[model samples]
Structures are given as structure tokens and as C-alpha cells.
Target chain A: MSFPPLLEDLIRSLKVLPGVGAKSAQRMAFSLLEGDRLGGQKLAKTLAKAVDGIQHCTSCRNYTQSELCDICANPRRELNGEICVVATPSDVAAIEQTGHFQGRYFVLMGLLSPLDGIGPDELGLDRLANLMATTEVKELILATNPTVEGEATAHYIAEIAQQHNVRVSRIAQGVPVGGELEMVDGKTLGHAFSGRKTL
Target chain B: MSFPPLLEDLIRSLKVLPGVGAKSAQRMAFSLLEGDRLGGQKLAKTLAKAVDGIQHCTSCRNYTQSELCDICANPRRELNGEICVVATPSDVAAIEQTGHFQGRYFVLMGLLSPLDGIGPDELGLDRLANLMATTEVKELILATNPTVEGEATAHYIAEIAQQHNVRVSRIAQGVPVGGELEMVDGKTLGHAFSGRKTL
Candidate 1:
């Protein structure tokens, strides 16, 4: 619709956020115009600040602002001969939330979907191998998600790690905790069945 | 959970989004990590640029990089003495999308909610009155939402507009275009009943 150009631009700007559809964008525009000018300003300011402030760690590919992201800079991170190879930074955060794993990470950037034009280079597999060759890494934790592409990428990375003489392991895939058997999707149940372990 | 301090900070940084809870933040963090470090960088860059580049229009209070937003700069908006007042910029967009109105707008910046400690001053109502006084504004369209606070704010503004010899009218409320009468909530029905037309 033809609005005074100012109003139209607000809706277009709100649409830039991820998962923000047209209706949600409209809501944000309304909120900003109505009285949440501060909120809108804050959001806009943060958006700019976060973009410029947060950068990928030169080593791990995690979000950071300075030369290295916070994780890469920490002394307590068990840089010990262990690195968790993951497909995304979000995966790293998920693993960290579990408060378990004590090591570093290598973000894959993408999977080796040759059909989709993504190759080993796009996934940064070469970079991971280079790091393994240079570092005294004893183990490589394969933490790629359980999707088809994720699994394929994990296997490919594992093979490379083996060639580099670094121990490789994959995160488990089975019935999730608190999972209802009846509600469990067939694919997940099938995966649970195939990956069954002896306790 | 003992995570690398940097990793922990990265997770903490993502929690500022509107609907993002801890779990969602964790998921986003993990996804970013698992994906390309470059992609994370790209997302960060985009966020920063949007925040820094956007500002609000001086006149309409809609987002803009300059003093006047696009609509306020336009020559053809609301020339016949109508000024639509809304709580948010999004409401302006909604009306524009319908392409129904032919007038300029004054975004209230927000509604006056006593419970929330919001009042007329916060909404810049005085500025609106000034605009009405100087401009050839005859009709003040109270296009605020139909919520209790929105309704109250409309009536309050209407009272002020009356003092200035301007006609004040409210947008209609009822079952939305795609809404089923059965599915329509009590509040909608009540507003419809109260604002029912005589045919």
C-alpha cells in the first residue's frame, strides 16, 4: 500500500529479522511507532552493534568481537588434545549447555553436499585436517547433527581424522531423554534400533 | 555447567531477542557454531548494519535514516485535512496495506496505560495537538487497537482533539475478514456489539 514513505520503510526494515514474517514485521513496526521507540532504537542499535562487535574466532569459528571470540580466548577451555567438530556455532552452544564436554570446536561451515555444490572446501574439512596435523589433538569428537547431510559430513570428517592418526568418535543418536515411545517419530525409532547399545 | 568462559559469554549474548528463551538461544547459538564461521560473521555483520543504519522519521516516528521518513517526504499524503493517529508504526503499515485511507499519520509512539505507568506525555500527544493546530487537519482518525488501553487512549486523545475543534473517529472492530463468528473471542464480539451499525 502507498503510505507516507516513512511508514512503508519501517515494515520493510522489520522484515529483515530471521523468522519475522510480514505479520510479525507489522507488529514490530506498530510497537516501534506506538511507544516502544526506545525498544526499536535499542533493537536497531543492538543489531548494528552485534554485527560489528561479534565476529568468528579465527581458530574455532565461534562468534566473537575481538580477534578471538570469548570461547577461544578462555584459559579454562580444555584445549587438551580434544576438538569437537560441529556443523554450526549453535551446535557448540547446545553442547556447552549440557555442561559436559571439555574441549574446543571446529565449525564445519557446511556439509559435503556435492550435489548441492557444497564440497569439502566449503565445509572447511581441509582446515580441520590442517589443525589436527599442527596440534597435539588426541581426540576428535564428531558432533555433527543426525540429519543425512550431518551424518555424511561426520563420516567424512572421521575418515580424515583417522588418516591424521587422531582418535574419532560420534555423538550418540537414540531415543532422547523423556521421549515418548508412541510419539517418537519412526525415523528416530529406527535410528534408536540400529544404534542400540549394550549397557 | 563448566564451559569455556568465552563459550558461555557467546551463549549469553544471544538471549536479547524478543521471544528467545534460554533453550531457543541455546539452539541458535549451537546452530551458528555448527554452521560456517563465515556465515556467523555474515549474520553478525547484517545485525550491526541494520542497527546502525536505521533511525526514526522526525515527523511520523516511523523508522528512517534521515529526519523525515519516506511517507512524510511524499507530496500526496493526506492533503484533504485528515490525520490518522495510531499507536505504532505497524498500524500505519496495516492501514496502508489496505490502501483504504488517504491522509497523513501521527504515530502515538504507544498507548497510555495507567497500569504500565504510560501516559499522554510519553505518547507525544502534545506534539500531535501542535500538528493539528498548524496543519489543516479536520478529522483525527483514532486508529489505535481495540484493547482496553488502546480504547482508553483513543478516547483521551479524542477529548483533546475536541478542544482543538477537530473531529475524532475510531477504527471499527469486529470479526476480522477471515475470522469465523464462532471462533471470534468475547472481546471482539463485545466491541462489535457496542459499535454495531444500524442498517
Candidate 2:
């Protein structure tokens, strides 16, 4: 009535992924088994190697196999004395793609959610503080999302930067580029009004 | 600027799954790396095992780790002397879920697509023919999807079944249960009219 034991196990294990449910898992299992066995085997080998080998970058808390991530390891990035602090590695990638920021990054890996037991220590704030105090870091840009927890995390990090005498600034919040002002949410429009700047 | 090598590799490899794109793959990779490393490792191990171990059932071509699939190996299912020919194992699962049919299954794994070079041999029609000719199968129920290729494949298989003196029947094509008459397509309405029977 059901799939073979191993196939069933694979489907169940696949559900551990974010956003994947029973139907998607079944489709994935069947697609791999019926059409692309080589891709399935390659995925298995790569997944095992990545899970076993990948670790956090010692300096920024970003994912990396080596002790330091690519940006943190770069001496030129250190010379800029600017560190953009974000909540996750995907945020770091987003900023990097803009090709504008020449500084390093500090990845918090998560926001400060006390209810979920995530706090300053969990976000690796102590390591960020150590870097700010020890390095010639002059500016800290808070690029966390514009959620309540993200704002709280940024405020917490700003206090740490103040103690280290490093200037701190939060990324601007406004109507997004190419977006209609009428389509913008009330909260975002409120932020746009309050954070208005002169030309 | 980019993710670490191992993380990037994992993201790329995760794209092998159907419906997964760059963003989804990235999300899956980060999700596993950030919070579910144990699950990721378990998935890797199970995926490898399923890829290596799962093979076609000798009798019905359904996926199985042993010589015969559970349904084909059962004597009760064989006693009906009916074989339901379907395009994929998922179809078998769907029929089994209904609990109405007590016959064995013949999985084609794919439809006959001459342009894609999928002929009778590719669909393992030879083995199906052998089973029909040698076994006590009294009827063959073609349960392929209601598509052009499915119709072609059903007709092809019906010819083979006729050669072996087995009664062949196609699953009905009509307005689905609970569907509105007006909403039904013209072709289905036509079929529904032609195939109508006394209540």
C-alpha cells in the first residue's frame, strides 16, 4: 500500500527540510528514484560532506569550513574599518551582491528572541564586541531586518559599539525602490515619513 | 561576497530536487546548516542507502529492496486474475488507497514517447507481455492519465493484451465526481454522454 521501507524513510527524512511537506517529499523521492539516480547520489555525497565539514567562521559567525570567512580573512576589508552586522548569512550575501560596501561583516546567525531563548550570547554578541574592541573597526552598520526583534538586536549591538567608541548606524527604512507609495504598508510609510532626509 | 565553498556546494547540490530553485536551495542549505545538522546527516545517509538499495520488483517493476514487491508477492492479489497497468508507482499508491481493487499492478514507469525515444522496450512492455502471455491474468485495466501520450500508451498495451486473449478496459473518462456539468470540458462532456449507462 505504501512505498518500500527505504523509500519511505527517505521521504520522511526529506520532510526535515524547511517548507517541504508530505507531497513535496514524495515527488522529490520519485523524481530522483525514477529519472535522476546519478544526481541523487551526487546530492547525497555533497550533503554528507557539507554537513560533516562546514563550520562557523571564527570572526564573523558566518558559515565556513576554515577558521575565518573570506571577507574576514581579507586584509583590505580590515583596512576599511567598517563592519556591517546582519542577522543571517543570506543577509550578508544580499549586501555583498550590491557591490558597494567595502567593509567586513558580523553575522549574528539569529535575532534576539528571548521567548525562544535566543539572546546576546546566542547571537554571538560577545565575539562582535571582542572584534570591535580589538580591531580598528570605526563604523558598525546595522543591517538586520525591520522587525521588532531585529530592531531590538540592532539597539543592543549599538550599545556595545558605543562602549567601544565605534560609530553605529541603522540601514534606512522606506518605501522600496520601484514600489508604488500607495501599495506600501502603513508601518513602512510611517517609517518613511519619520526617517525623511534632505536632498 | 559569496557563501563558503562547502555551503555553496550544498546549495548547488540541493537544486537536483524537482521544483527547487536558487533561492529555495539556499534556504534549504541554510536551514539544515543552521538548525538541523543532525537531520541533514540523517537525510544524507538515508538518501545514499535508498539510491543504492532500492530496485525494481522482479514481478511488477515497482520499487522494492527485495525480489518481489509486497503486492505482487501476495497470493490473495493474484487470485483475482486482474492486472491494472499504470504509468507510475504513484498511481498504484493512489489505487491502493481506495481499497477497492484487489488485483496486481504493472508499472510502466513512463509513457510511450517516440520523440523522446521511449518505446515499448523502454517502458518494459516486453516483460508486461511475457506476464500476460504466461500468467492467468483475465483482464487488464489501463489506468494511465487522461493525456495524449497516456491514451496512446493505453491503446498500445490494449493491442498486446488482445494478442494474449486478455480482456482490456480503460478507466472511464467523464465529468469527475462532485464537479459541475457546466464547468466540465467539452471532450469530457462528450465522453460522459457516450459512456453513460443505466442507473
Candidate 3:
């Protein structure tokens, strides 16, 4: 038998989430309906609020409720003149959690994927260039992840920074801080050897 | 930096979903806010609709918008005199997908967990007894999971059926159908041996 109209619509709508399949969607539907009606109401209200209110920061493309995100609006981050270019907003959050980088960020919003039609324009490279022209950005750190598309995106952004005479540096790729040498992958080991630093 | 108030609230509300942690909730919030605002709106509308409209079926306690759930409303399922009793709506979905069971279902909604303050009334065992008394039920097949609480719930409901002189049967427990015997756990192996049928 089929679910009632609204229940069916809810299950279908829930499948849009990443990693959630038909079975998982059904499980989530039952969980919310059977156990937490208040939670469901809260989720609905929160989702509506976020969807209606949130917008991308004009300066950095990160999600924000105002014209500028907190990081972009911070006076200290603006003066730092160090912009870390990342693939997505989640990457911005990851770097922020580390508390090591005290500068700003530029969210590319996507990686370069020729097959998927995500080109320089799709990654908002032109917007990055415009931001570079308007600000006293001294350095551009390419912090895109190490994959084929990520590498292409980083290189593309590096070229853009070079055109603006801005110094470009890639985040070090090697053995992670606490990783075991034995567990490190072959390509990373190779990069570690080739990009070794002198004390 | 912390998320804005609405975003933070959305993330926290999302955590009430089963298996969603802080990181996952944040990701979901960002995904909805950044790229899929329409999806967020859809989810919100659907969730609100389901929560507000859906109600338990009077006969089977399964989710429904009408007085009776689809299964209980169907004349064919009602006349079959076979009631498959399960602990959750997901179980009903699983059994229905198999297409082997033509009879109706009785959803217990939860297992008997005395430690957590869940007892017979919480699982609605009295309601099951009432349904059995009123309906032309010939067999009560206990389809609860293989966990301890599931077992207790099944036995409790079975006793209830027995009190009304109704035949009660538990779904089999053993090594899974395609599972290797060598890799099977001891308790399941023991049940497999004890419940062996004549060749």
C-alpha cells in the first residue's frame, strides 16, 4: 500500500539529502513522525527561516544572514590581507575550527570539472579577480583539496593571483601532523619526499 | 566563528534526526542555505504537512491521514485473518516490500523497555488485545526484531493472544539466510541448532 499524500511527499523530499536513500528516507520519515513531532515542527520552522534569511557573503561567498559574513566583516581579518581560497563553505568552517589561520577566505563554491561543465566561471573566478582588485590582498593561499578537480581549481586560481602580481602559495601536502609514516598513502609519501623542508 | 542564530537553531533542530551529529547537521543546514533553498522550503512544507496531518490508524496504530491506515482500510487485508505484529513502522514497510504477507499489520510503535520506562501500555499491548477481540484474527505472527527488548515485546504480545485462545507464532531466529555458519555469532548459531526442522 502507498503512504498518504503528505507522508509520501515528505519521504520524497527527504531523499534530496546527501547519502539518504529510499530506505533511509523512509526510516527518517518514521523517526520524525513516530517519535518527535515537536522536532519535526522545529525542523520545519528552522528550515524555513534559514532558507528565507541566509545569503552568500558578497565579499567571500560564504553563507551569511547579512551582506557580509562574520569572517569577512571582522576588522582583524580584513586587515590581515591573507585570503585562503577553498572549494566550499564547509572547507571554510574546517579551517576556522583549526584557529591557526587568522585571515579571510574566498569560497570557490565548486571545483573545476570539465565533464560536469563546472568551469572557471562556474567556480566564480571572475568574482575572485574582482575581489582581488578591490582589496589589498597580499597573498592567495590555494587550500583546495588534493583531487584532480581540486588540483585544477587551485592551479586556475593560482594563475589568476599571479596575473594580479599577488604571491600564491599552496597549503603543504605531505604526512599529516599526527599521521603515521606507515599509514600514509604512496602518492602523499612521494610528495613528502619531493617537497621536503630543511630545518 | 559561530553560525548565525537561525542557522545554529536549524543545525540543532536537524540533530534530532536519528544518526545526525553536529557536523552532519551543519552540513545539511549549509547545503540547504547555500545551494538548495527551494529544497529547504520543500522539506519544511512537507515536514509541517506530515506532522500536522498524519495520525495513527484507529485499527492498526500505523501512520495515516484518515481514520484507518491503508492496510486496515483495505477489505482484502482485513479478511485475511493474519496479523503481523511489528515494533515499528519501518518493519511494516520492510515486510510489505517482501510482498509475501497478504494479511494486515499491528504496529506496536515501540518495544517493551522497562528500564527506559516503556511497558505494556507504552507499546499498546492492551490495544492489540482489543483489536484481536474485535477482528476475525486467526494467527498473530510476532515480527519484532531479534534484540532482547524485541523478544520481550513479542512474548508479551504472544501471551496476550494466547489469553484470547488465538494461535501465536514468532518469526524465526537463526543465522541469516545467506550468512556463513563459521562467521555466525554463538547465540544465533544456538537458535539455528535448536530450531532445526526435520528434513
Winning model by lDDT: 2
For every candidate, C-alpha RMSD to the true structure in Å: 5.5, 2.3, 3.2
In angstroms, how far off is B8's CA in candidate 1?
Answer: 7.7
Q: Could you give candidate 3's per-residue lDDT for residues A142-195 as a string of tens digits? A: 999999888888888888899999999999888999999999999999999999
TM-score of 1: 0.67
lDDT values, one for every candidate? 0.71, 0.93, 0.88
lDDT of 3 at B85: 93
- Candidate that scores best on TM-score: 2
Candidate 1 segments whose C-alpha is farther than 4 A from its true place: A1-16, A23-80, A94-104, A131-137, A164-166, A175-199, B1-17, B21-79, B96-100, B127-137, B161-165, B172-199
Error of 3 at B100 (Å): 4.9
Model 2 ranges off by over 4 Å: A174-199, B178-183
DockQ of each: 0.17, 0.75, 0.56
Off by over 4 Å in 3: A193-199, B75-80, B97-103, B134-136, B146-148, B171-199
Q: What is the interface RMSD of candidate 1, in Å?
A: 5.8
- Which ten contiguous residues of candidate 3 chain A have the minimum total lDDT? A1-10
Provide the global lDDT of candidate 3 against the true structure: 0.88
Most accurate candidate by DockQ: 2
Docking quality tier of model 3? medium
Native A-B contacts reproduced, model 2: 0.85
* Residue A186 in candidate 2, Cα distance off native in Å: 6.2
